[model samples]
Target: MHDPGSSEHNNRIPKPLGEAFLSLLERDQRRMLRICTRLESIADGLPGSGKLRRTAREIAFLDRAFDRHMFIHEKFLFPLVRSLCDSRESVEPMLCQLEAEHATDQGLILEITAAYAGAIGSTPRAVGVPLCTLGYLLRAFFENFRRHAAWEKMLLHPVVKDQFISETPKHQHDAVLRYSIGAGRSGRWFPAVVG
Candidate 1:
């Protein structure tokens, strides 16, 4: 029942990264939830036979989405924040923690992918392994992303606005361009229908 493009679901625009990445994350998260829900439904329907191909395809798609999500956060968003945020004391540790989380995220995605593929080629009991792996990964992603977004909104954005006034004018303008380019190139993260 989640609407990926619904404005109500979109996160408020953080001045650092702009609203575009937040919108993209909202849309992508909804799409991922939809895919996971559909996969669960499909799995539920095939109780005994174990539809390997369908499960494999779903897992593959999820893997691709996770990859793009990580890339955007690590490569584009994090670097921008690091460059702009003047407080080395607070920002540095947070960025380090965020990077560590990203690594964990990648690990979880890889584990899910491997387990899902292995399950597809193995016995029925093995199917549960991937499902559980995906469930954990999804939960972790939701928790981490929500926390990260909140931190940016409440703490980071305000600091940037108040203390780092010098960057404000250029920040907003750059944020729009960066986000537009990032979103446009995120065709890999988006579903074919959205693309």
Candidate 2:
């Protein structure tokens, strides 16, 4: 129910960092949601086991994008958030919850992937799973992922935007640089995705 754009404090994220990293993460989340929508439609239209491979393929694709998505969160955003917060205890619970959800998401995807492979070239009853059952799992994965991503956008994004420390523009820039993405890491800003 929370709105990501609503900020209670006057503090603002540095334009460069916000535009380059935060906004892109949000964009990625939206992209994932679109994928979820597609997956939901696939689930709805599934008529037989023949389409289960397509569901698996789409889930596999989503898993790749999700890896990059979680990399940004675990490597950059969460660390910056922890640093900016007045008390680590306050934010730790939320961070832990997100991390836990990440694990659950990965587990579900893995199960779906394995099931897809196991069911290949086999009948639905032989695999002990009906087409409708796989469809149910696909729907569940996307729905759960949708809720998780939305929660992150609603709770975390606004916190990052408004919780930063700054007095003047110089100080703001310093703060931004200190917590900027890819700091003290490889020159590569992002992992390359081979299309």
Candidate 3:
């Protein structure tokens, strides 16, 4: 068994499948950051900037991307972590907490979508509560999401890296397919290459 805290384990690269999983997650997060920056600018210029339509569109995109990202975590990453770590007692709490956060995020997204759905026209007053709520909601989601992603990366990556370090390439590929395709049931969304 690999000692997760050992310096050697910390320095080792994750096995190919684990590395690929982390890379996909990191890519999604970077994309999210770009969208968050864009949303922040829109929020800064809110209320009467005639960006209502654009805000709606951006929020929609964020909603979809965020939903998919969270699905990958809840369905794939968390379970994989649970199976990989010998000390489930150490990791289970974090997974549960993150899952709760995912629920909260979904609720927030619904509220945001509802707010923007009713919002119409370019005037500040016409936009009403949505105009008032939009900036705060966007900030809340983006801030929480950024923190959550960073926390997950910090806590989980080391375990994944250490656990897979000694796994053979064939074993790695089979494991990836087992978790990411057969069990995750999300192969359509993110197809795993058998090779």
Candidate 4:
């Protein structure tokens, strides 16, 4: 068995897949940061800022993106981790919490969307509750998502790396081949060329 502590086993998703996944996550983080920063600016000032409509569109788009991202994790990453984890107990609760966050995010997005619309149509006082709620949720969502990504990096990645490393040389090579061919990115199918 390969040692979990081995540096070679410190990266999950194989090299190519991991790199791609990290890039995607980083891009998503940038989006979240932009949303968070935009949200923060409104908290201190009146929503009369001309940016409400644009920011509303971005938040709406993020709502859909979050759903798709969560679906990807649920369909691919989390299952892989669950199958490979040394103990399901160690990872299950975290997965559950993260999944639950998706629902919470949906609700927050609704509130934010409504707030944006209200602020645009009428006075800030008319939507004070939603405005306040939106500001709070933005900070909460960004921080929680940042921490969630960190947990995957620190905890799940190590476990996945260790599991991948534990495979026989042939299997590791096959995994790389499969991953490189887009198996990890999406459920694409072709005969896996095995030598």
- What is the TM-score of each predicted model, taking all chains together? 0.54, 0.72, 0.73, 0.60
Error of 4 at 59 (Å): 1.5
For candidate 3, the TM-score is 0.73
lDDT of 1 by residue, 1-195 (tens): 988677866764545544544556457656655665655555455434234567567767867876776666666655555544445467767767767766765676676566655546565545546455545554554555556556645755555444334445465666445444442222222221111
Error of 1 at 35 (Å): 4.7
Clashes of each: 0, 0, 0, 0
Q: Which ten residues in a row have the lowest lDDT in candidate 1?
A: 186-195
Best by lDDT: 3
In order, what lDDT does every prediction score?
A: 0.55, 0.68, 0.71, 0.60
Which tens-of-lDDT digit does each residue in 1-195 have in candidate 2? 755666843456556644455677778888889888877887778755336556666877978988887887787677766655667688889998998988888887776665555446344534655566567777788989989988988888877767542234554455456555433222324322111
**Residue-pair clashes, model 3:** 0
Please state every model's RMSD to the true fold in angstroms. Answer: 10.8, 9.7, 10.2, 10.3
TM-score rank order: 3, 2, 4, 1
Candidate 4 at residue 65, lDDT?
Answer: 73
Off by over 4 Å in 2: 1-15, 49-56, 122-128, 164-173, 180-195
Q: Which residue pairs overlap in candidate 2's backbone?
A: none
Give the winner by TM-score: 3 or 4.
3
Q: Name the regions of candidate 4 deviating beyond 4 angstroms.
A: 1-15, 42-45, 122-130, 164-195
Local distance difference test, candidate 3: 0.71
- By lDDT: ranked, best first: 3, 2, 4, 1
lDDT of 1: 0.55
